[model samples]
Structures are given as C-alpha cells and as structure tokens.
Target: MSTAFCFGIRFPMFICMSSFAIIPTSIVVERAIALWKRNKYEHYGCRLGFAISIICIVVSLIMSAWSMGKMNLSDLTVYCSATTNETADRITIICFTYCGIDVITLSGMAWLRTSNVAAMKGKYSDLRSSYQLRENASVIRVLLPLVVFDGLSHLVFSLGGGVFLLFRVHFSYVAYRTI
Candidate 1:
C-alpha cells in the first residue's frame, strides 16, 4: 500500500508534466511544419493543436484522479515509501514513459526553437515583424532550457526510485527533493 502511494503520486505527476511539455511543443511543431510546407492556410494547425492539447489535458486529469483514488488512506504521509517487486516494475515503467515523452517533446521544442531563431537571423519586411520574431525567439530560448532541466531532474528521480525498488537502496532523498 505504501508502494502504491509512492507511485500513485509519481505516475500522475509524470503524466501531468509530460502533457504540459507535449502540448505547447506540439503547437510550435505544427506551426513550424506549416511554415516549412509553405502552407498559407495553416490556421487549422492552431485548432488542431488546441484540440490535441485539450484531449491530453483531460486524459491526464482523469488518470491523475484515478491514481488518487488508489490512495485510500486519508492520513497517508507523503514521506512514506516501500520497496518491492511490484514497485520496481512501476518505477521502471514510469521512468521509461517519462523519458520517452521528455525526449520527444523537448527535441521537438529544440527543433522549433532552432528553426525560428534561424529565421529571425534573416531579413524581415518590417520593424514590427522583426520585433515579434525576436520576442518569440527570446521566449523560446528562456523556456526550453528550463523545461529540459526540469525534465532531466524528473528522469533522475524516477531512476532513483527504480534503484531503491530493485536494490533496496535508500535514495529516497531524490523523491523528497523532486516532490
């Protein structure tokens, strides 16, 4: 049950954070693709991107609620933990899934950032166009690194939990710091 509590928190969090990364990164990706394809009628990408983001958000929320339901004890301590075979498997799954999403989303964001920043270095027709491009580029430059850093820390926490589960290691500080 304690093991359940540990994963109950982590899986939901991974789902939520991964969704956050995927949604915006996906929008930028879609826009980049539209520009690459020279498609003038690309407003549809906004709608499609929003639709996918909504679906991902809703699904993540529901899953989070479902996992919370598994935590039956009202007075359960967040610090409580356990190591067992089941937990090892759960940790492995969480780590792999989290890393997979991190790679896909962060890589897409990096690509989008590179393409837009590259375009910003080229000629823009007007002052307003240049200003907006530079602003967008700046935002991406600031945000993507933060996202990558946070995601990498999450990966470390998941791996730490996995090691604890499999080897009875007491690296619970990873969870404490991360959570």
Candidate 2:
C-alpha cells in the first residue's frame, strides 16, 4: 500500500517528465532563438505553456506529498499490506487525473505550436526564407515521432492503469520506500 501510494504520486511525475518534457524545452528554445536573432519576441504562447506546466507541477507536488508525507518509512513493514479502500481509490483517481492532465497539456502545447506556426507564416509571408521553411519542416518531422510515441506510450499507460484500478491491486504491500 505504501508502495502504491508512493507510485501513485510519483508515476504521474514520470509520465509528465518523460512524455511532455519536450514542450517546455521547446518553449525555452523558442525564447533562446528570439534572443539569438535579436527579434522582437512574443512570449504569449510560451508564457501560457509555462503557466500551465507550473500549475501541473504544483498539483503533482501536492498530491504526492498529501497523505503520504506524515507516514514514516520505519512504520511500514514488508509483511503488512497498508491500504484501505479509500486510499486505493484516491491513488487510482490521482493516477488517472495526472495522466489525463498530461494528455491534455500535450494537446494544448500542440495547439499552441500550430497557432504559432500559422502566425509566423502570416508574418513572414513577405520575405520568404527558405531556411526558415526547412527549419520548420525539420521541427515538424522530429516532432512527428515525439507525438506518435507520446500517444502510444500514453495508450499503454492508460490500459495498464485502468487494469490496476479495476483489480484494486494497489494495496499489495510496501516492499520499499525512497525519498
């Protein structure tokens, strides 16, 4: 149960970091590019992305530290299962909640990126830069795999998580704990 609780909090962090880390990183790169090129940068999309990501992080931290913070590692023994129906339900729900947020944020970032691209195309229509077109194409190509893999990974996660939620096996036992 303790193990489940810990993972219930941490697994979402893993999914968010692994699956959607690129969005933040790309946003950072966008800003850097603007700085490097000395262009007047519109940070609206990046700002919105950062705001949403921060909100997600805060929620994750709160959920991770919520009930499990008071419990000490010394109190949990490997011999005992440490879960109740309420705990199990909360953990399951938290897991799904985090996963859902991850999916939503990923789509949100995609939507923002599309809008940014459209805006850029409109803004730069006059001075058509082949280099920029090539760069955009390359970014889209690279992002294609990221989006595909993200979707596939989330699908697998959802199915496996749904199974765990269905079986109520989150209370198996606390084999180990980490800080």
Segments in model 2 whose C-alpha atoms lie over 4 Å from true places = 1-57, 67-75, 79-86, 125-140, 169-179
Model 2, C-alpha of 161: deviation from truth (Å) = 1.5
Quote the lDDT for 118 in model 2: 62
The TM-score obtained by model 1 is: 0.53
At residue 17, candidate 2 shows an lDDT of 42
Worst 10 residues of 2 by lDDT: 170-179
TM for every model, in the order presented, reads 0.53, 0.49
Q: CA lDDT, every prediction?
A: 0.57, 0.49
lDDT of 1 by residue, 1-179 (tens): 35456656566565665465455555555545544543333446567667767877886665444434434343444454322322345544544555666676667777777787787778867665565566567667776777677656766765565454454444465653343
In candidate 2, how many Å is residue 35 off? Answer: 14
In angstroms, give how far residue 44 of model 2 lies from its true place: 10
Clashing pairs in 1: none
